[model samples]
Target chain A: MTVLSDIGHLLLTADLWHAALAAAVLLLLPALGGVISERSGVVNIAMEGMMLTGAFFAVAADLILHDPWLSALVAMVAGGLMALIHAVVSIRFRADQIVSGIAINIFATGITVFLINRFYGLQDVGHLPPSELLPNLQIPLLDQIPFLGRVLFQQNVIVYVALILLLLVHVLLFRTRLGLRIRAVGEHPEAADTAGINVYRLRYGAVISSGLLSGLSGAFLAIGISNTFVPNMTDGRGYIALAAMIFGKWTPFGAFIACLIFGLGQAIYDNNSIIHVSQYLLSMLPYILTLVVLAGVVGRSQPPAADGIPYAPGTE
Target chain B: MAASSTAAAGRPAPPLAASLRRAGRAVAVPAGSVVFAFLMGAVIVAVTGGNPFAAYQALICGGFGLLCSGGENAGLQVSNTIVFLTPLIMAGVAVALPFRAGLFNIGAEGQLIVGAIACTTVGIHFAAAPAPVLLPAVLLAGMAAGAAWAGIVGVLKALTGAHEVVTTIMLNYIAQWLLRFLIIGGPLQLHNGFSVSSPIGAGAHLSTLLPHDDKLIVFGLPASVYRVHVGLLIALLAAGTYAFLLWRSSFGYEVRAVGQSQKAARYAGMSVRRTIILTMLISGAFAGLAGAVQIAAVDHNLTDKYFSDTTGFDAIAVALLGLGTATGIVFAAILFGALHGGGAVMQSDAGISGNLVYVLQALILFSIAANFLRTLKLRLPAVGRAAGTPAAEAPAGALAGESATALADDEGLA
Candidate 1:
């Protein structure tokens, strides 16, 4: 069929791979954050909302400061504040993590739109100026490597940073002492508390770090990929990242792989002109695939034992 | 939340006064949370250079038939509130039912959409059918579609041990996309090239309680403008059914047993898997009925507007705010429906963002989670959960208790 051949041709083209890589990094950041947060036993479905907040703040800051890096930092801080709310409610008050997460999302959605009305007075949040936007790098020597170079080397700076952070998170989750404590806290908080590890603190840190990563992803989406911020511009990418997290069985490296698969789907959707399918129908591919993958893989995957339960001292 | 139930279970008030006091303590937290959020919303409005009082006044006028001004009739606002509340009651029950069984039915939005689509499909084809033959048929089709949509999540959860939250969210996206595909340049698009389906035949329309004559006036509005129909009664009946089925029936007892303790329920000879699946199906049916009612009673056709319909998401807030009680859901739905009705007026009159209502809703949920009012119970004589325990945390915790975290146990076996 024409659709199959067109997809094959698209796969062979370097542009498709390059776009997929960009999209993968976008998902990878949040997926990594999800891995870190869930690994520390806090369920975070609010990544979508947090990322949207980050995207809004990132664009707002960039518009004011004329510096992409500063805006990105502001975005991260904004996300951290949202996560702090989740931490206090779920960890301190022992609220249901799902409810708390959903609340954060709803809060972010309402606050962002409300702020827009206050700030812009019904005007659209405009695009960043060229000089103020995140710059793409074309590695002098590496860019010469034909297909691989175009797909991997010549990309935005955040892409490189995300790849490195992926490695760092992977290492932090598996190789470090703090990582062991976090895993212990997530798996069995009572045992971790008895072992003298600060369960609450680790969870707080992991959740905050997830917010930071998600925020960075949001910044990339606003300044690095898209020029301006739209209300709910992040769309469902945060949820897709969540799917990536589950598909990877909650591992940073495995999540990266899942992100790439989802990214490919997104990239293909972006290039829907070649595919002989409805654009709306094409948009459903990633979500349907997530459902299928979840149905197939969730039975075999293992999450931390105390994953959604709040750890109350002396409860056990 | 688990805290409320635990508090009720832990303490048994002896005298009538003690029982009243206990009931007061239970109502205080949610009521206080709502009040606190409104105060905070007022502050935010003031900070944004808008008059909070005026905005709230507009909200009140838009939500109910009181203090209306500037060409806005009191009757219209009340009618708007009723129309908005109709679907929410059923959708709230949809979310609330699964919460009792310790399952999160986040797929209600997707199910609602499918139900609407099914209702529209049946209504469009059977345009010639009279009211009696058509009404139940479209509603059943919608319910069937909604149940099928939710059934997928149930089966996945029952067999593969997938988290319903994730699956439901995924399904929500699919449903949104499916809706877009159907009405936009797809099979259902209107002939005039609008991104809406053709209006259903007049025979398919629900009859208005008030005569649709301009000569008829109630509260200064023509009866023809009143969109409130028999759907309100249906919603109320659905609420009653939800209460009876969830509280008075043996099946409800089984569901509660499974929710409270799956191990205990299994030991008591209950089939855990069947209960899980059945609860989801019933929940889906309620959500489907909401969608069906929305299409049959209000919209009369599929439109792009359904893409932004927050009925399903609002249902989550409704179910939680109501504490999963039928009376609570009705009251919560009315409150939310009022907020929604008032939002447009606030936007027009106060030159303020309609989204302030959403912010208020979120704030209320946040305050509920914080359970700040639970501390008040401590001042009362030996009642409520432990000194610092969140008394409002029980129901919400139960929501995620069995399903969200249930997969952890199986992860070990795998």
Candidate 2:
């Protein structure tokens, strides 16, 4: 009973909601990316690595270029390159997609740490200046609302962008002809290929787009949410995003709802003092919730038929 | 050999030669991958303005104690390599077993940790017990815990259709955090602030390869200098068991069949779900043993070091580069153990970062999966009809056999 009230009281605070929204955006971008990539029949577990690479480069580029937008662009390009490696290895060479993805993750970790040590010479990558950091904005009239304003209207620029991308991806995946083709390719690549849909191109495009969004999330993590980049700064958000994607049944809107739940967990973790329990136990909540959700929901979720199988043109 | 003598009565030499050639090619692929990865590493070192030859020289010296001039002894270096190889052998088998069953068990790391935790708990709680009784108890406890951890994934895969890949990765994080919780102001923590557990009683310690007395010397070093333990023998025994279970046993035949073609296995009256769960249980036991051995033989307690344990992850590469075979896994573990043991020396001697080894491992995975040489064989019409053709065609055949299993594991979750 006390625990329930504690959670209720915690939810009542606007700061918690805002933090939850921020956390959701962090997961939402990659979850959206995962949805798109997987919908095109490519399994992308490399998002964690890609995001870390992006986060590293974003900080490096921001430190050198001093422009947040340009640094973000650099981060996206870096992430796209990693994704291209995955696409080529899995699609072109017909390697196991999961192995390729795991390799990408290990490569990202090694290269990032190597570069950091080589470049910084044991010095820390300093934090971005507040003036140079990505700015948070508040809506004009909506900001005047007592509770909702603080929770929804005022947020980092990336939060708004993420919400917009969520809507755009939903429409693009469900409503657009391109979206239908992507789904068809994932569901039945041979059929799509026979229909002249060019399955490889759609898959490559979807995967690279996922990289771009993941990179954007990395940039936001470094410059928008936190001031500086740390090694493995993205942590397991990329993986959590993957869980969100699975929990959402591989849908943009569904992923957003799942992300909200996970993000709420993270936000509550961030404010652990008020929970009146061991902080260590609190730290386990997100993972435990994800496992419970997966055990419950994954049994019912139907993924694309051709997912994780490489398209061999006429082989199918 | 006895059957071959009768079968080859007419042309025994040719069949024997063909089998020898097939074995040679199997050895060559992994060897070529290592060389190719090293060449890539050289290029990276050159690009980074480091001396590639000097770095490699340092690695060899550190790994084998070859060409050592300073205070470093070959015995100590060899011992370090063996220590690193011990856990890798079991972990490698843990992964290899699953690969033969067509399940990618990425949760070995989690299984290993739970194993270590279980071993520590048992050792600490039964501190008064004799080594004869307590040692086996802790080891079995670890195995059981690890099996249970992996059993969760198997059950989920069988009943709920959850992909083991995602579940395993999620479990890795959970296990990591659980370690932190236990050692940092949690029940197992010895103090309020430290991220470490109390040491287990001495009875839990595995007998070292060398005598405990520092005055006693063997292989040009004091006995105490050798950290290698009886765990190495246990690892070897586990490998032997893996070989027997995978090749000589009926259950292994079912596992291989399920891995090759789940539908076919089912048609042959094999319970696909039972095989998967059992295979996972055995694999998890091996991984758990690796963890338990690591704690019992080396650390003697849980520490922050276990939090960053890469033994399970490295086992993935060991299983792959080893081509999912027991003998191949041992050799692969040796090579990786050498690299890990030599990493610090490369950093200190050649002025290159130790992470160069990781890059090399990843590159090896890339090149191995690309199967460039095999592709060349398939492309060349001359070679296509010759000795290399059948071997080149084998992966495709294997893929076809495993496709149903892979499909069930990946896309059939629903």
Which prediction has the highest lDDT against the true structure? 1
Please tell me which predicted candidate would have the highest TM-score against the true structure.
1
Candidate 2 lDDT over residue span B1-414, tens digit each: 334545767655566776886788788777887998899889988887778998898888778888654456788888999999999999999988988877888788999999999999998999889999989988998899889888888877766666777778888888888888889888789887788898887888888988888899788767997999999999989899999998999999998887777777777877778887898899999999999999999999999999778888888888888888888889999999998888778777776677777888887877676665665565677744333222123222232234334436533432
For candidate 1, write residues B191-248 as lDDT tens digits. 6567898777666677776888999887777789999898899899999999999889
- Which lDDT tens digits does candidate 2 get at residues A136-165? 999999988998999999999889999999
Model 2, residue B143: what's the lDDT?
Answer: 94
Model 1 stretches with alpha carbons more than 4 Å out: A297-299, B1-15, B191-193, B375-393, B402-414
Kept native contacts, fraction for each prediction: 0.70, 0.46
What overall lDDT goes with each candidate model?
0.85, 0.83
| Interface RMSD after interface superposition, each candidate | 2.2, 4.2
DockQ, cand. 1: 0.62
